[model samples]
Target: MYPKVGSPKKVTMKWLDKAFAPLKDYLDAHHPENAKAIMGWMTYKGNFDDLYCYENRMTQGYIEFDRSGQLIRCSDNALDHEYELGYERIPVKTESIHPNVDRWIDRTVSAKKADIFREELRLFLQHVWGPMANYDFSDLKANYPLQGSGSPYCLYVYPSRFSKMIAFQFVGDEIVEKNCSLREYQKFEKSEREFMYQGWHLVTLIREFLAFEPDLSTTREVVRKGCEWADMRIDENTEFVLTAEARRMLEELEKEESKK
Candidate 1:
């Protein structure tokens, strides 16, 4: 049949280990490859009242084990959610088939895939942003404010100011690596119309270009083109308006040009 909560007891790591020990040993001995893949371990937590009270409420945790019986990753949600009754374990009905055992296996596989995705995304961000260890950033946006073409892209603005903005484009769900490009804000606006007509989903707009030390020449060229485009737009159209920050950046560019 199914397991039932027999009694409530204070949950602890020791209790979780004691409960999952048999399952861990079984998986390690029989499914060594799967155990090693998921980074197995056991965890537990107790439920207690906010006002210095203790309630004997707990829930079973998920665990994974390697062939050598080493722990990898484990977690329990007992203290996070109410379990109605408490934690209890059903005796393994069959050595080869059981719902509880199957559930943990599924969880382990899912966790492994999730970890892989996280690591990939982390490396992708680092490659695109390039050693962001020193930059102060704010006004972050991820998968929101859908573009007019109904596509969402990630954005990260630095220094909490509108002085510079970086837009990231993605192909499907994966980021396009080493593909940073820059275009004037006005030119980008014009291009968006073309993109919308052509059904293109990704676009990057560079309003103000910030120089990176030990710079990549290609990135600098793109930023330079953006600045040149903005300068042409300003000179050709008296009606074109610039944001306050944009205006300041343009003036600074003018001063730098005069010095050269």
Candidate 2:
């Protein structure tokens, strides 16, 4: 719940405007009804009488104007309308900064990177586990490489329907250690093959890094396959082996990923 009216805090119109600006044309074109409705409602007063008063109403005492601007004994319809319009205008801000913020940086991906990798992973999952977990592939599209969290490469893997969270972090550009709770895993019955395939797929994906450096000549080789980062644990279980070139690429990827 938001703070009550007159709570002595300012609503960030600038931030909200910036965040929601990108959606303006989109909203206007696709959702003109909502756009027109909000525009029409903006003319009315709202519950917060002080904020949404008419230009003339400013001369009158702030409280004198009902939220709706019409001077009834207990009417602030303008303010109420402003509140509603303000709420509707919110999405303009959220859609703007979302892309540059790397919201989709490290979410999920297609099963096919290379034919071999895809086939191998599919087989590994299908054969290894008797009952593979189901998931929404679209979630992969939202893979955000979040900072100040566990591991450099945080992946949202679904080990089971009930045990969906299997956050994995990279250890030294190689190993991808999982962040599953022992209790959660114990509660769910998974085949040995499922566990092995998950581990193998992660390693294989990491090892396939290319050099992603700005200047390919001076820095180590860079790979631009996938990018996301999290504050992952570095431990024995988190290590994987890569080609010397791939290792160099991954180390650089880690540094670049951190900057984002």
Candidate 3:
């Protein structure tokens, strides 16, 4: 079994707490209109060891929105099981520069296995988050295609005057127009139809852009698809999808982050 790192160092907790202190203080001081949303996440209940374990299993890097609405980044610990995955329950000693050389061969083997797992996980995360992890959204202009009457295929043409660009598709000369919005196109309602609605999907995409603050290409792609999906018009009889334009953009967004 790997050696334990003992109790967490006070300094580490201090730094961690300090990381969220300001945001927590902000919510306590001047409450914003979304104060409820922000305040609800102020306290985190998970153990770091367990948290790291889950993160490792998911192969996700330790970047998450903390309870205080602050961002915490877990650096890639390729050699440590817990660090690599984001959980802390591994039997191996973590944060220890010195390992028991008495069992050098076994420790070395365990470390190697751990390293392989970490590499696989890192690759998975890179594929999932994509170029948006590296790019910013301010660089791209909206270019949603105009869906003419009755056509199934849609495209992005330009930014909208209001929150989103509106596009139309047609079937049998019947014109179907969809209006798009950048944010909050319509107030959120609690119906399954409304929740699963394309408009909500667009809003989610916008939130993703703002949350990650990805690169220009990534941002533009997100905004473009968002606009395209927002413009799609669906009816009781209309075959509805998330939209190819939107899916393509999302695919690019989920491409490998590392150029290599």
Q: Number of the top candidate by lDDT? A: 1
Task: Give the lowest summed-lDDT range of ten residues in model 1.
Answer: 47-56
Residues 1-260 of candidate 1 have per-residue lDDT tens digits of 11211123343455444434534465577667665332222221221121111111233444433333444333443123323424333321212322332332234324443343333223223322333422212233333233443221223112212233323332222112211121222233453455345433333522111222223334445543543343121222235668999999999999999999
* Model 2: per-residue Cα lDDT over 50-85, one tens digit each: 333221122222222333333333233322222322
By TM-score: ranked, best first = 1, 3, 2
Best by TM-score: 1
RMSD of each: 23.7, 21.1, 25.4
The 10-residue segment with the lowest total lDDT in model 2: 218-227
TM-score per prediction, in order, is: 0.22, 0.17, 0.20
lDDT of 1 at 43: 28
Q: How accurate is candidate 1 locally (lDDT)?
A: 0.34
- Considering only N, C-alpha and C atoms within 3 Å, which residue pairs clash in candidate 1? 40-64, 41-64
Q: Candidate 3 lDDT, tens digit per residue, 1-260?
A: 11212233232555444443544454456556554454332332233542211122223333333444443454363112322424333222123212222132233224433332332222212322224334222222222232222122221112233343332111111111112111111221222133244353332222222223233236456545765566444545555468889998877877854453
- Provide the lDDT at 77 for model 2: 38
Give the distance in Å from residue 254's predicted Cα in candidate 1 to where it truly belongs: 27
Q: Which whole-number lDDT from 0 to 100 does residue 235 have in model 2?
A: 43
